[model samples]
Target: MHPASAWLANESAHIEDEADEHDLHAFQAIRRMDEILVNNFMVFQDVVEEGCYDLVVGDEAWDVDYFLHENPELKRFAFAWMTDFVGWVPMPDGGEHEVALTADYNAEMIEQRARYGRVRDRSIFVGSPEDVVDLPFGPGLPGIREWTEANFDFAGYVTGFVPPTQQEREQVRRRLGYGEDDLLCVVTVGGSGVGGPLLHRVLDAVPAARRLVPGLRFLVVTGPRIDPAGLPRRRGVSYRGYLPELYRQLAACDLAVVQGGLTTCMELAAADRPFLYVPLRHHFEQNVHVRHRLERYGAGRCVDYEEACDPDALAVAMAKELHREEHAIPVETDGAQRAGEMLAELI
Candidate 1:
């Protein structure tokens, strides 16, 4: 959701309502009392200071290193997400915390080795084969690369993550417009955390695309972070505000005009949908992380924000991508359930 759009209507209430009735699924089939899995490192301090959680599992490739180094005492109660990044973890006075590390490094993680290289040998690191106490790694969703198992303590790969089936495209398309034959294009720029400008540019294309394709319907997603002040008040643009299952919309579309967010690209690819991918300017995740991953697979064409801002340039890129017929990068989807089970075992 958009971080600063609290004034806008909250559409996640339905999700929150569902969560209220959950059995702590996601670490899945959640026990009534279990360790806190910290996906976002920003809340590390809060969970630690409260000292109420039986265990707190830190789950980031890099962020957890700093969090654990600061609180050595918490290590006993910690179950951390580890990767083969080989970064040195700071230990307490010739002593190492028996921290359990889990990694599911896809191809992009292998490519981003330099990011880890900067911190790899920087004195404080305690990363060695022995430092790793391996649990089953993540399901390497969206095509993470594999390294030699001998280099790490003990890590193995599994067909972990789940992707929507090819059949989901029809279901999603039907939900968007029942019994309709309009050529719909889905435009999204990930969550509210990013894509404010990209979305405006996407909306801008709507007017032009309508003229280009007859009976066009634009599904413009305004995430929580996006302020829907200047949304196109056009005939065909459907201003969908922050759908939790936004991927369903992507599956239903004839074409996808998206920014470089891996999960978004993966979902569209799962549905066998082609897209015009516009990577965010100077953002590593967009330009570097998912960029190499997607391009390597012949999944989509790249566009710069500058070119996208120019209507003619974006149209050319969009037109070029639309002409291409096939796009498929297979990703494992069982990681959702497996990752949950791994976290659940943290206690």
Candidate 2:
């Protein structure tokens, strides 16, 4: 792993907890991007020089395409996985100039790539145009194809447990020692330590929520970055370290409480589970892009971090959402296959 990975993870926690420091954090993060790109370019260059590969694929890493473009003599086909839209990001200051500022930054990057002669032979959006935040350049940006939600299968991309069957759900619950009558609420913070605050708040509301729903149980999965021992222990709530197949557990649960990250939110949506997502303040991607997609799918309920900090309010919301029936539109499960076929054509 690059040396900056650990620092970036630590910075993510700091930014998530201290919303006031967002601007400073953003500056620091942007400064580190060049270093990361350079490191990636060096490593990739070494590997490519050692082998003869037909195609280069990048999974949300722009550096891969950058390296390939820079070494155009290699004459290799490049494929890009654009997991999210790139333009129209909101500035932290929320000033009137934010739109122009973001647009200019995006335009600069596009211009740089254009100068390099369109290295990306094929690129696909992981989601439909509806899932995209309205881009300044619009969806028809050259050399990019979009996978409609109905055709963009997320089964292999996101998690193996796409939508658990009734039997699979029962087996997962049994393995977790949950009773059939118990209403299970799985709380997760994705892979970042920044979710510590949200996890603590959820733990605080457990007592009140459980009182309202007698059979309610909480399963808090402190991901790899978080130490489960650091959290408070309480009845009706079970704390566990990272689980390999967390989505399976999530799919089987009665409800889910998660951070505003797209992966976790979309996992719950695919499982058709009722969930409450708390997006970090000033997180433009989470608050704007992910929120729009979820709204389009009629998925998770959005609760602001401040409202969630109030234990009483969070408890009431949790209880209310737990029993609420969701009729979310089904996400397509064949995206990986479609993507494979597209890449196969290039080979």
Candidate 3:
């Protein structure tokens, strides 16, 4: 099950009963632990002794938050790698920590000592073959390009990300209440953390889009952590606050409008959905990730905050990327499959 579904199944009862925020969070954490326990998610065991995994892929927060709460066992054979565009997640001791399977050599030994219990016995910390060096490197490696071109529809770039299968396309349409003719759906994701600025700009860009596509529908999925107040509330725009069908929603749309966060971007790519991205100004990592993806595979168009706010520019960009008789540049093969393959190799 997806994380959101797991959350609801694990915590709905406690969440309904609790009145305090602290209590709710505690119950939620407990629910997470329960899921891990019941699933017998011995990540390390599966990776090491059983050799059941090959690779683990995600941004630092996803790696840290996920394993810390559940699947710690997998860390044994997991390659805790990272791209440079990651900001450390804050730990309870008042400092931020990189979400790696293994501690960095340069980090304070005390911090490493604290991680003694957390680090798996056998693991490697790598920067990957395609690590970005500087803005001049443009995109990373040819593999990323090969992946995109092979899987995506380049001529239909304007049509949005290509759905992997007809079934997924239908599910998305059903979920979004779209008929075959309702071709214009713009999706926005990542409601909290650094995506806030990017989301705000998208809302600001909506007016510009409405001018171009008068009947366009906006589907926004503010993350579970964010409040609806953070985004502009508009009519004709459907807001499914923290819904589970994120990939489905993106697939249903003609184009997605979102921040350059890795997980969200990866999901968009997996859905083969074309998108228009806005990199948040203060979030350097997000900006870098967006620029890298754009240069590497033409997966989507990048619209910085300032650019997204410009009515003429935003409209032009969106039109070129979303409505043209073209499709997105392909992405690496079904990333989830690739990820699973990599995990298998690791074991």
Highest-TM-score candidate: 2
lDDT of 1 by residue, 1-347 (tens): 43433333332332232232111111111111122223333345445465655545433434444435544444435444444223222112222221121132223334343334232211111122322323223343222122324322223212223445556656666766734466777888666435656777766776676666667677778777666665657677777667887767776777888877666876776666778887654343455545555654567777777778877667666655666776665544544454455556555
Query: How displaced is residue 173 in candidate 3, in Å?
Result: 0.8
Global lDDT scores for all candidate models: 0.51, 0.71, 0.50
Worst 10 residues of 3 by lDDT: 151-160
Q: Candidate 3 has what TM-score?
A: 0.56
Off by over 4 Å in 1: 1-55, 61-63, 82-167, 178-180, 337-347
Model 2 — which ten-residue stretch has the worst lDDT? 142-151
How high is each candidate's TM-score? 0.62, 0.84, 0.56
Candidate 2 lDDT tens digits, 235-296: 98888889887888898899899988888898898888999999876676777778988998
Candidate 3 runs further than 4 Å off: 1-163, 191-193, 229-231, 334-347
Model 3 Cα shift for residue 94 (angstroms): 24
Report the candidate with higher lDDT, 1 versus 3.
1
Enumerate clash totals for all models, in the order shown: 20, 2, 28
